[model samples]
Target: MLVEINLLPKKEPRNLSLLFAIVTFSGMILIGAAFLIWQMNEKKEELANVENQVQLTNEILEAKRTKLADFQSASSVQELEKAIKWAEKQPYNLVYVLQKLTKILPERGFLTEFNLEKDSIINLIIQFDTKSEAAYYLNSLLNYKWIDEAVITKEKAGDWEIINNKTPLSDDQLTDLAKKNFFPRYYAEYEIRLNIAELKQAYKSEMEKSKEGNKGEEEGGDSP
Candidate 1:
């Protein structure tokens, strides 16, 4: 019977080998895709970790810099204070000492040469109308607490005085640099030198010793 005949050949038993090949290929593709996804996720995690580390390092560096700046500011202030204290401890004030010296000068008397020595000796010159005024000025200088000794080194009279190498003062009757003695008009100039060192205890002791020696000498002289 020519039934609708099993056409082709029994539908070719379903080609199992080809189906197995397709399934294997599909499974391999799936496994490859999953591995790629896992690698991408791991790389993202590593990048995140690196970013966090960089941020933390920057924060620490900034903190250290701020601390260093503060330390430097404080150190500068402390150093300035130390420098001021050192300046305050210094013993000499030239301007103040000069002012003190100027205040003691007489109205008519003026200084010609005044110089300070390295060893605290003062070489000074003062000109006045009369020797009496000059002597008075010298005694007054010695009375100052700062002066240890005052001595007049020389005295001279001149009608014309060479106050310095460059400047000369003409003491005629008009300028009164010179006053008339019996002979001529002349000015008296005094050259004085002095030492200034105030050691209170030592000076007191010296005075005591001098008084004792004088008393002993007087007693011996009286007995003889």
Candidate 2:
């Protein structure tokens, strides 16, 4: 009989514990992935909301800027109109202007007629007791700083013309009284119209400042 020998290798026990550990770990990873996906979606929604709010704020600021520009334009127009009105009234103050034409006059020199014209011109008509007094008054007026151009057009002697010899006083006495009234500081009655546009310009500047202040307050009060 032939000896039969069977050489068969025995397989090791299957690793059941390793298979269980792998399956449990895979399930945990799937659950973790689902949680991470949920968190990412929540963050995306929050970012989108923040961007929307920023856009809205920008729109509001632009609208307020537009309104402010419009208000400024309107204010400028109103100010111009008010300035024109003020300039128109500047010529009325010429009556109070002091034109000290006669700096020094002889005791007998007296002013007879004074005329003021609207065309910025000065006209003077005077009668003096003597030609020397007239010369003195004329020279003083020419040297005066207020008189721009003092021109003695007609230096003629005048005899007293009796207009009315009424009961009040004699013409000669009245002439003496007139001479005495303006003695030592006799002024030739002259008309001088000065261009006081400089004063008007200064006043206009102040008026503009006041208007600007009012406008600033209005704009500030409307601020949020």
Most accurate candidate by TM-score = 1
The global Cα lDDT (0 to 1) of model 1 is 0.64
lDDT of 2 at 182: 43
Q: In model 1, what lDDT does residue 167 have?
A: 51
lDDT of 2 at 118: 50
Task: Tell me, by lDDT, which candidate is best.
Answer: 1
lDDT of each: 0.64, 0.60
Model 2, position 61, has a per-residue lDDT of 91
Q: What would the TM-score be for candidate 2 when compared with the true structure?
A: 0.36
State TM-scores per candidate. 0.38, 0.36
Candidate 2: 10-residue stretch with minimal lDDT: 157-166
Worst 10 residues of 1 by lDDT: 179-188
| lDDT tens digits, residue span 62-150, model 2 | 99999988998888988999877764665633333322433254445445666565545667767565444656666666554444555
